[model samples]
Target: MPTFTALTTLPGQAAAEAFVEALERLEPEPTGVGIFEIEDGSGFWEVGGYFAEAPDAAALDLLAAAFGARTFVVSEVPETDWVAHVKRELAPVTAGRFFVYGSHDAGRVPEGAVALLIEAAMAFGTGHHGTTKGCLQALDRLVAAGVEARIAADIGCGTAVLAMAAARIWGHPVLASDIDPVAVEVAQANAAANGLADKVICLEAAGFDHPRLREAAPFDLIFANILKGPLVELAPDMAATCATGGHVILSGLLNDQAEAVLTAYDAAGFGLCNRVEIGEWTTLTLLKPHG
Candidate 1:
């Protein structure tokens, strides 16, 4: 099917929400939206929405003005070709024992490194980003701590990188979810590619708000590697799903944003177990207070 992908940056506090709402109000609604960070260094968020048909000239003109004193553009994209574009453009990622292959991290890993091979698709976690790697490292350290955990959840599992990692190394039962259909497909494919198909269950979900997420309550470990906003919003849900004394690890946050995230987590009664930094990203581990 054909789709439209538009990426736009709006300055100021509500950029992310504005772009998201505009895409939602479109006549035919986009198939998906790929949020990106432009060079602005502002909190401004970008969205690449996929539609069912080509956007006409009028669409572009309206798009440019939608942000008003901001920036935006719409491009028609065929559904089948977006993955090829992702593989060609996204940077490399390395998390824990996994090394994501891309132009930047290509050939830079040590010979004996434990690597998780991945292609750049619309799916989230690639080991190269600090948030993903931070979570992976935290997970590994937990295992190293010799804590016995039974069930695990990867909310916003993205490319299923972390889900696959947990399942592959720990052999635990895993559930992975993503709001994006493309990400769901990618996560499933990547898990099977890593021979983790049996250990990991991949599905589509919009945060912990999914029916399945509610059904599978009280997970021993939970991972959410999304933006700070969703992280804060989903705090209560993540805590509810965690088994008492169990753990939750979160990422996709900058160091400056860590304090607010910690406050949210704290309010949910999940105290900080540890924190790590990689490049410009932050990951935190938390333990549910025992009753």
Candidate 2:
């Protein structure tokens, strides 16, 4: 069975959503349709669809023209066992004290390292991407500096890897939240796989918008490894929810975007304590002022 995808970018959220609705109505209807903000400080939104059969190019062109969107780029996705491919290609990642690996690499965990079992099929944060690795390394540095977080939260925690790491190191329950329900389920599964199900509590919420997160406010440590735009937008809320003298680790930023994120946190009463760059991504450790 072959799969096809069509992707395009439009200017506004409303327009992008409308475009998705139109996509759902097309002949050879898409198996799935999604829309997401580009998140690079660009005001554009990306709309995409997956199909079991080739989509009609003429209909796509007409929809794009009507919605003032860029022409859709359609491509056939090669049929491959993606899980098997990821298992072969993704070697275990060692970030200081944390070791991230799939079950296939179970034999490779080193002595005394905090082992995190993250299957390739999980949502994200398998520790393969520079962003996730950078964030892990930043957390390692904070522990080395004797930072103690009694209450921690991992916002936008895709697979709850960060939350699990915090739980493993500090022996405390860590709250992990993701906007997607599927990701929350994956996080829970990952936590149970690592035997940290009690320590890493997974929830479905956007940023800090859930009742559980609000009740657990004034967190001692926080992790938000989302994109630059959301990081900036989250600055004020992070400041309000974090205890004075608490710490936040942020990533999912290009090197060029680090300064803007730093400035946003600074204005929110946080001072940069450490910055780490791995490849093109930068991770920041920021502390809320005790004043």
Candidate 3:
């Protein structure tokens, strides 16, 4: 069956969310509605809805005018096997000492490499994106520098790839958490697939709010590959939760936004140790000073 999508952008989060709420209740009834920040520092949010039937264009136009948003661009989405499409589009991605691939490419993993199996899914972090690959490379560099983390956490762990990578290298437990429950579920499934289900624990939490996360506080290493806004907001919590001399590897930032995020972490008591730029994205590795 063919699916239809209607998309538009608005100035603020509240307006975008409200638009989605109204869009869901439209005559045709959307199958799903999604809202996300554009990540361009423009403070604009994108609102989109998927429908089994073509939405009423006039209704969409009225909704856009009411929300002060751009006119909705409606398109028909052709029916395709998305998983097979992903398998064909994504080749194995290798970053430093890590190799990430789907089950179809299992035979291609290089020997002695830390391998992470991530199926193509609705969630993010398959180690194919620059942000995820950069983070993996940073992890490899840390290992090269003789850094061993006994207690580690991966914030916003989408597929739990980073957390599983750390666990495979250090032979220790890793806490992987994401604000989205779907992401947490996907992460857990990926962990089981990688044979690290026992080592990488998955949780649903927003930036270290869980009791388990608090109990695992002062982590020796942490990975937060989320966007700049959340990274800046979580700086204090990251600092407080990170052990002195601990390391934090961060990404999901454009080159221009790295300075502001670094400044926030700097005030929270972290010093940059290394940086990597993959395309427009920059990944940072920082260390909390040891007194």
Candidate 4:
């Protein structure tokens, strides 16, 4: 089966969402349509659709124009064994004390490293991306500095990698929440796979909105490795949920956007404790002060 994808970027979320709705109503309706914010501080949203057959280029162009988006670029996606390809391309990643690898490389985990098994099918936060690697490195640095977090949370935790890491180190239960139910399920599965099912509790929630998260307030540590916009929006909530003198590790930011996120967290009562730059991404460790 040939799969075709049509993708375009626009400035506003609203426009991108409306464009997605339009894409769903096309003559040859897309098999799936998705809208995502481009997290590079571009303030742009990308709208993409996949079709079993090639989409109508003329219709896509007209829709793009109507939505103030760039011309839609449609391309055929080659059918390949994506899992096999990812396994071949994604070697194990080492971030400080944590080693993230797929089962194919299970035998390669270092003797002393904390092993996190993440298959490529799980996708997000396999520790291969700079953002996830930065967060893991930041966590390792905190541990090396003798920081102990009894209670922690991983907000927007895609695969619960951070939560698992904390649980592995501290032997304490960590709350892992994601807005997407599918991600929450994946998190739970990953936690089980890592044998941290008892230590990492997975939930479906946006930021701190769920009851479990609310009850787990004043967490000793929090990891919000989400994009800049959500990170900024959740600053005040993070301040309230984090305990005094507790730490928050944040990533999913471009190097240029770190300052803005810092400014937001600073205003929300966090002070920068450490910052690490990996490739084009930046991870920040912030501390809440005790009065």
Q: What is the TM-score of each predicted model, taking all chains together?
A: 0.72, 0.96, 0.96, 0.95
| Residues 24-99, model 2: lDDT tens digits | 9989899999999986767899999999999999999999999999999999999999888898889999999999
Off by over 4 Å in 4: 38-44
Q: Tens-digit lDDT track for model 3 on 175-286? A: 9999999989998999999899999999999999999999998899999999998999999999999999999999999999999999999999999999999999999999
The residue-by-residue lDDT of candidate 1 on 1-291, one tens digit each, is: 655666666655466666677766775666776665543366655666677776554665576576662444656554566567677666555455555563334577668555565765533567766788899889878888986667888988888888877776677879999898888888888877767888888888788767766787788899899888889999988877899999999998988888899999999999999999888889999999897
lDDT of each: 0.76, 0.93, 0.94, 0.93
Q: Residue 107 deviation, candidate 3, in Å?
A: 1.3
Candidate 2 to native Cα RMSD, angstroms: 1.4
Candidate 3: segments with Cα more than 4 A from true spot: 121-123
Arrange candidates by lDDT, descending. Answer: 3, 2, 4, 1
